[model samples]
Target: MARHTAFAAICVGICAAGATLGGCDRPAETAAPADVFLANVAEYCGKAFSGRVVANEPPADADPFADKNLVMHVRGCEQPSRELRIPFHVGDDRSRTWILSRTDSGLRLKHDHRHEDGSEDKVTIYGGDTVDSGSATRQEFPVDRESVALFQREGLKASVENTWAMEIHPGNIFAYELTRPGGRKFRVEFDLTEATELPPPPWGHE
Candidate 1:
């Protein structure tokens, strides 16, 4: 009890001495769930991790990614805690990137696709925003009206109802998922415990 009291006294004296700077009694504001999730992912900025297809329904005999290496590079953290652009690399193809950013309401997720010549793909920048306060380790983004319109215009009726989700468990696994009606689902999980070599920047991001 005496040791505890002494520690408390010392803390109090320090606070009193720095009272002009700012009192230690200021109330702490708790970060929202979306913010926490973004921070959790930002912890892996500047690193690249290897991943594998964890789930892919309606399997195809000629899966394009079956024999290719899969990697995800967490980069473009220049926006500080506000945004991150993670490139999804499949072997030598660096055409896909996942852009996650903070929104006034919750969060936003978008897909950026580019050609080898650094040209933007026609059906690119289609994604959605979080509708609720998801947990710190996970967040789900349902197809928004804009993305739906884009898909419809591109004749991608099946993707109009797509819902994408991302999960990040520090030091364990980070997952990306896509689900839609008619039992369509795809998921890839990256091993966060080990970061692989940093790959080249996503196409158009160079």
Candidate 2:
């Protein structure tokens, strides 16, 4: 069907490249499962949706849902490189963005926080990469070494074990979640059925 064609369009070239190399370092690159997954979410580009924190048992160092107006804007996509920039806004603060980029292994997710002056936050670019070929609608990223180092440098030792996830149940729901050491967990789910007008770009992104 057409959906399958789109999947092929996104996945085939990367796969063929792997074969040309005689084999790829990351075997998952052969099928490009994350490529299909990215393509699925890319369908929502330019739209914004509201969400609520469904799970939040915050630890002492954690602040969950301090802002009620939660919005996620699937703002940009570059099909050639397989990248997505989703700005996550909460109330009046436009400081957070979720950057997803394709990799030979799977996918990488980075939390890019910025100051009002468009400067990167001290703890920015901290996140993880997928360890497996996740499904077309879901993916999990375990904290990567670079993120651990960043957290340690920022005195956020507790977040070194962070694990983040994103899910899309086309036309139904889209969700983001975080889990870290010490049983801390936070989750927010967006209603994909109701698309709101796009909000302003996140700080440093405009």
Candidate 3:
């Protein structure tokens, strides 16, 4: 009888130990999905970047060089999922919105650009590519042909042909590169040490 009691106690202790270890591992397994999504968004939020713009050909009577400075913010995100709304301002007149999410098809990116007073720019929906390679997340977008033609008609052809690239480092560094028609390119790199959520844009609230 005593031998049987001792064996039962040993089994109970072993089971308890296993339960403790299993409990400890649960959080990690459940949290991994959200962690990965937030990590990518945190990489570029609240950062400032600077770069230049070169045109394929100088306008007949305009300057041939332009420079840009931009600040990026991760406005808000849906938890337990990979949906994010990122807003950015470039120089003084151009503001943009980027919607990012993880889809079965891969990471998806959509862009919307607006003028200083919140009017839609010549191009509204610009398509882009995104990749989350273990170390960093990167995106590249080219101006759409329809938007390019609109810009051309509006006398802003030089700006329409620029291709944009953005990269977010795991350490919260944001970098951008812009290339114009004639292979002229500009690059910017910045870090986001402070992240604070701001009020949503008017349209967003609606």
Question: By lDDT, is 1 or 3 better?
Answer: 1
- Between candidates 2 and 3, the lDDT winner: 2
lDDT of 2 by residue, 57-144 (tens): 7544556456569999997665533678999998888999999988867889999999999999999998899998888788999999
lDDT tens readout by residue for model 1, 88-195: 999999999999997777889999999999999998998999999998889999999999999999899999999999999888999999999899899999999899
For this target, which candidate reaches the highest lDDT against the unseen true structure?
Answer: 1
Which residue pairs overlap in candidate 3's backbone? none
Every candidate's lDDT? 0.82, 0.80, 0.50
Q: Runs in model 3 with CA error above 4 Å?
A: 1-38, 42-69, 91-94, 130-135, 141-163, 194-206
Clashing pairs in 1: none
Query: What does candidate 3's lDDT look like per residue over 13-86, in tens digits?
Result: 32354422133224322422223333455434443333333333334354323444544556554321345666
- By summed lDDT, which 10 consecutive residues of candidate 3 come out lowest? 19-28
Q: Global CA lDDT of candidate 1, please?
A: 0.82
- Candidate 3 lDDT: 0.50
Tell me each candidate's TM-score.
0.85, 0.84, 0.51
